[model samples]
Target: MRFALSEDQRMLQDSLAKALVDVSPLDRVRRFAADPADTAADVWQALAEFGLPGIVVPEAYGGLGLSMLEAALASEALGAAVAPVAFLGSVLAPLALVRAGSEAQRAEWLPKLASGEVLAAAAIGEPIAGARDGAGLVAKAGKLTGRALFVPGGLAAGLIVAADAKGGLHLVRGDAPGLTRAVMPTIDDTRRLAELTFADTPAEPLTSNDALAALRDAGWVILAADTLGASQAMLDKAVAYAKERRQFGRVIGSFQAVKHLCAEMAAELEPARALVWYAAYAFDHAPEEASLVAAHAKAHLSEIGRFIARTSTEVHGGMGITDLLGLHFWFKRIGQNRQLLGGPEKVREIAARVQGLIGA
Candidate 1:
């Protein structure tokens, strides 16, 4: 049993990196800032063809049935390229349903999603759920009436929903007669989010504590991987600028201050990278502790990523702030990722609680 990426994984990463670079270039990300339809459709279509859309779906369901670690690695690559596809929303959410859905439901829906015939989304962070003193939502019976905000790729979802009702997960159609979706403005234009309202909409229920938690835990791990990738991009950008930018009589990169800062950023990044891999490793081996470890990974990477993005911009001077130099891409994503998965403080607090550092 080796604990390293196999030859196949490396090949997968290399192939995807080569193909997606052209579609998800940094310059194109800038242009898509205000365009709702500015998603990387060609890239997504290609990925579906590669069987990634069903990476975790079972063979009976038309998926590769790969491990969560594979999904995490793929997610990291997507983030590194700033690819504009919603693997989390499109695949992870449905995988959640597949894990917990009844046999009948799984037989009906999983194949559709695995083949990319129907896109889905998970709506966990509804307004009230994430707001101060927020209480989780419950979907009772067939009708759902509530507001789910900041739902990523919701507008593009064919089936969208994830509300806990009496200790069970609920699913809903995106265009259920009573559903209303409106795209919400976000700093990261590459990823689309929305405000979804379910006005007496229909829903299906899936009951399985083990499966539900497994799927959600997998999502947390993937997000951590995303943060690590984004942070690495920022680090790379800063290093390049330090090497090329001039100051005084020579390249500013030679200055002790710049070197020290870059070194510090590297130091910060290393721990987060370790945490992410460790968490993903835990996801496969230690299902019971995966949630806490995933939270830990997400917490560490998010803070470090934000720090790197900010400093990357600063090192580039005023030019970095301008769209021309494009440091804002990293900065905006850092801010977005900070809020994603509940941020550092939220996750740290949760982790501490899990460890009994504070009274539960």
Candidate 2:
């Protein structure tokens, strides 16, 4: 009858949060964001040392063999700190390999991926399925050609798990012939996006037909969890500021309006945390409901995340816009999460179709 994180899950979240705070403080994040050449290597290594890179990998391949719930927890931790690590790719690559890859491919890549000896990026956004504005990938004869946009962590990835037209997943080496990566400018530099162009680039395809669907579901859950964490961080900052900021000989926390804003944020965000946890739990334990719940989680959190970000910024007033507080990082992170994979409208449409309320 109880729905809550297990004691072990709580401990995992606490330990990882502490590690992130130590390795990726606001100052370090600012410096990393300012330098295009900076890859946040220290933070990435710290995460790897914490075994996040291998969280979901099967024990046979040296991973912790954890489930999607644990992965969601790790994502929450990352979003709370706005750490600039390539987590999406690291998590998804192993998943793709495990679900769709051949025995040879799994043996060759899983261990390296689990150990963080190689970094991977993901280009599995829905836009990759339908060529738009001259984007999207096409696979033929074990090679891929065309373009994929908004590839996260693509710039530094050694491997890329790309979804091609027709919903097939392929693994493309970062240095594959005729492949080029270009960074896309965005408000949130904490997690960089890239445009990948492949011209007759060699690729290895995952054999399973369901791999892409699994990836999509997992992606939705992870993005939702990330937004939850970022929103919580923003709310925490707003509350902390309200208690200390004084005006008219009284702390801002004494103001009814301020208390209402913080209370509203809490009311909206706390329920969303449950939604994310349920989505993640369903992904691992209730496979039949995973897609629907995942879509709901992602869409709902995107809307709630925006509310928290804006209201939190409003709480800080002028200081929110300034770089000194570094609040914009969390704000921008929420904005980006809102659009990643699928926005609210798109995800809701998918959910509707899943329930037979709309045509696919």
Candidate 3:
């Protein structure tokens, strides 16, 4: 069967792209990175004005009530612009709650999250490349004590959904009595990551234990989609550079070697897009296939994204490394995206489990 985006989905994607053009240009991204605080308040406000924070939230909670597929489309646009926002952290925390929280919990958190009044971040992957399951924190007597590292947007988040050693999900406020966060510097300045330490921090348990796998798969799918967008942007930049930069009295685009590089990059990235799109669609429609497809998409796109980032930089020669061209933003973003959630090796192992190729 042929898969295609519906008209409304296409329109939503286009609208978000148009909005980012003015709000999160490369110069704006550079400015945010240069600031010590690493915030994009104006750019975030622009996205909040567009109701993106509520895109995947239920309608009862003041959201558009869209599906994961639509959210993936928005993610693509965010990746294309390399916009500095907490979209992943904000969306994933609420999603975990929505999937497993009690009715009271949903009533309290979903509306605020939908309205962008509060931002949520997930502290699932503790050791960067560890298992996506919440196996890092140990819970006792309604309090948690452990360290959760590499939490994206944790320092800026108002609420945090943390995973426990037993696969249980817990919600802890950012200002809780025994919680501390420190920003961790990463290669990608556009995204913020933090290491959180909990010293008997109080937390509320989410009731839905079955939702953990779903949430993990969703996170992988969104990251893959983001990488897909970044890959395309890098390819576009490289092509533009090849067309304009001249060597030996002719445009570099005239050279067969440059043409081959661009062509090979396109060939690798184009198929990866289908994998990401299909993975997102599967999450909404086919539950049995979602995990496997999400893993495949994340693994494949991450590798291709690295290749695109490297090849694109080479296309510009020394100019690519200069801050003036701003190619490093995409390059660094791809580098970080590769290891988030889990690297290709870890994800491929997960996929093998789904296929019964290895013992669980």
Candidate 4:
């Protein structure tokens, strides 16, 4: 089977790239970053107008009813622009609801999510879990009592898809009586994170046995896609800067060192891009391969994105790290993506287990 994006997918990708560039350029990102609230209301509304918030939701729920590959493409555009919006959480929550929610739950929540009327944060990676793999959440008496750290867009979510220590998933209203949220300090201001504390919070349990694994894998794929997009942006920026910047009476692009740097970034990026797309495809078409491929995609892109981020900054020299150029936005975004949902070491270990290379 061909592993390339279809003509329609390509058009969607192009349109999204252009739309994001127009609405979320560097200056807009800078403004959002500097805003104490860190909200991107205008950009978020623009994306909603494009039906991006529900890219992965089923069509019956007023969504586009697209697949993971389409979601990956949109994510790549958002990452390239480094738009300050909670696209990731919005995408993943619906996936969980579709997989696990009761018919009633899906009917109630999916439409709101599709219309961008509400935001959903994922409460995975509780400290008690000791890993980012969405464990250590405890549910008792239909109530949740645990702390979930690094909740994506938690502070703004109207709903939260939280995990239980036993691998069960639950939908908890963000305004549950015992729920409290606080913004966590992060290296990447563009991706807002919040810490959530629960004390006997009421939660609606989901029944789908496959929900946890599928949701986790979906999250991994989106994260990988985001990094893949950011890496490409880094490569483009580096090449553009090299062609324009002068050193020793010659364009830096003419220098062997600069050429090699840009070439290496491109080399690292190309394979990762293909791998990310394949991971998205596998999630939709090959369930057996989804987890392993997601792990591989996330692990590979995390490191490669770091390299691109650093090399791109080097190509710009002193200006790369400065706010004037806002290259740090991409740099820090890659940095944060590397560690989310576990770093390379952690993801690789999981992949090894999936390959039966280690004991369960």
Candidate 5:
């Protein structure tokens, strides 16, 4: 029942944060927004160099063979900077694949994913939510044909993981025939979202419809972990601003209202951290409940994380929105997370359904 970072986890977390600060600083995020090639290659290499891309994979597959808790720790550190690239898709996408793929499939695909030789982007969601029949979404047969919006780093991805009409996972080569994609601008400058279209694209089934139903739920856990890191960054920014920005007579942080707000942000962060870790633990120790915990974590963290981000805008006054300051970066990150996998209401309903609160 106890949740805390082990000694090695803490060290690795610090190392991951420091490494990103060195190679993927805030300035890099801005520049990358203008030029997509600025730091991705280095960042991608750094992740591989640090054994990051392989954390959740088994050791035999050329990975660190660590658990989701370890991967979540590393992910949280990257989230602090709103780091470019979809670490989850590149890392966790394969985990889901290995869990459901055939022995031949696992032997080949996992090692490539672990060593960073293959990068996969999860293609889900649509901007309009309708280019096809209204369904839960699915990937079927040996072909996947659909459009997905907001694919993270999708422009550079070499593989595309998608869901077809049956809600099964289909792994399609990035260069497959009848496939095309476009990068779209997003509120989060550090992240890249692409619009992807597939027309009878060749695909390899990663998992069946029933199995995908579960992995889809687990996606919320990874998203929640990222949200927690973003909330922490916003909280840090608000505190630093409160201390340095002078008021009528003294620093605003000295005032009771500002202090209370900061304290509340801190309190909210605890629950976010606990829930994320709980979700990670479920992924590691109790796969049965990972989906439920993922829904709970996403629902709770999304609600509070948005509150923190919104309050930070007010705390920083008008400067919060301006490029002169970087608060908008984290604010936008929160916004992205809110709608990335699903909104708070959708996840809460999932949580409710899991507990049988309402009949399906």
Candidate 6:
């Protein structure tokens, strides 16, 4: 069986990377991060023109009708650029609607989401419908009460797919009555998070019983892929810096210790790239294995991404921590990806439970 990406997938990755380089370079990301008010509107527009917002939406709904593998590829490119766009929600919201939404829901929202006319966010991180921060939503009589934390793209989303305490999915409009949103600050400013409070806010329930499982699997795969791209970028930056920086009249890259650090990072990360690909492929092809594989990918990449971030920074010496080279963008991106959804320990526990090695 072929385990490699098809030629078309490679082309897609290349094109997206090039577009991001032109539109969201490190300097542009820095400017966006410096100002909380800057929405990175032009960057998101470029992505919309490239069809990223609609990559997985059905072609009938004005999307490319691509698979999760393609969406994961897009995520990898976005991670490499560290672009300040609300992509996690853009992808997840459409996936949720596709999997569980009624005909009217899809007909009403998918087209607008695909065309970038409406922005959407997904607040499904709660595993058992409760957040680690003691925040969660309760659904009653077609309304939601309580709160959701760490909602990506919540501040600007026109629609939100929230999971309730019963593991049910519901859709909430951004302008719904009694709905309130507050931005949640994090170390990584490129991706904005928000806390959502719903006070008997009206909601529309999705019909599928299995949508939450599918959504979680896809989330893990995408987050793992994002970490993969960001890790590779940091490693590349470190290698480039090592080659140029001289110590004792010789390039630092020539030192045995530096060579080992670079080699170790490559050795560890290169194989993990295949892990992410397989997880994504499983999501689209082998539903039975998707959950376990995605959990492994997310957990493994979180650990590896952190290692790469630290080692890559170490390679840059003092400049790594400094803002001059802007290495912290990739660093912080990796760090944030590590904790999003579920961290390594939490994901590993899920994997173990899935395998029946532990009581669920």
TM-scores of all models?
0.92, 0.98, 0.96, 0.97, 0.93, 0.98
**Local accuracy of candidate 2 as per-residue lDDT tens digits, 1-360:** 778899999999999999988999988999999999998999989888899999989999999999999999999988999998868887889999988999898898889888988898889885423355878888999999988888788998988998887789898987899999899898887989999999999999889888888898898899899999999999999999999999999999999999999999999999999999999999889999999999999999999999999999999989999989999999999999888887899888878888999876
The digit string of per-residue lDDT tens for model 1 on 1-360 reads 686778987787677677667666876666676566666667678778877788778887788877777777777777777777777875566566666777888887788889987778877653212542333454666677667777777887987756653345677876678888888788887788777777777888667666555655566778778777777888888899889988887898999988888888999998777678778778878877887998887777777888888887777888888878777766776677668647678778767877789985
Encode model 4's per-residue lDDT on 46-134: one tens digit a residue: 99899998898899999999999999999998899998887778878999898889999999999999988888888765531244444
Question: Which of candidates 2 and 4 reaches a greater lDDT?
Answer: 2
Whole-model lDDT, candidate 1? 0.74
Q: Count clashes in each candidate, considering only residues at least 3 apart in sequence or on different chains.
A: 0, 0, 0, 1, 7, 0
Tens-digit lDDT track of model 6 for 62-169 = 999999999999999999999998788888889889889989999999999998889999888775323877788899999999888888889999999999977899
User: What are the lDDT figures for the candidates, one per model?
Assistant: 0.74, 0.90, 0.87, 0.87, 0.77, 0.91
Which residue runs does candidate 2 get wrong by more than 4 Å? 127-131
* Positional deviation of residue 105's Cα in model 4 after best superposition, in angstroms: 0.1
Candidate 5 lDDT score at position 173: 81
* Top lDDT prediction, candidate number: 6
**Candidate 5 structure quality by residue, lDDT tens digits, 1-360:** 445778998898899999989978888777776786554777788878888878877888888888778777877887888887688676547766777777887787788888888887876543112233432334445776667777776787787777665456777787999888787777777788888878778888865546565555556777788889989999999999999999898999999999988999998898779889988888868978887888888888889889999888788888888987877778888888877767888777767777899886
Off by over 4 Å in 3: 131-135
lDDT, candidate 2, at 174: 76
Worst 10 residues of 4 by lDDT: 126-135
Considering TM-score, which of the candidate structures 3 and 6 is the better prediction for this target?
6
> Given candidate 6, what's the lDDT at residue 310?
96
Please give the distance, in angstroms, between residue 298's alpha carbon in candidate 2 and its true position after superposition.
0.5
> What's every prediction's RMSD, in angstroms?
2.3, 1.1, 1.9, 1.8, 2.5, 1.0
Query: Model 5, stretches more than 4 Å misplaced?
Result: 36-39, 126-141, 207-209
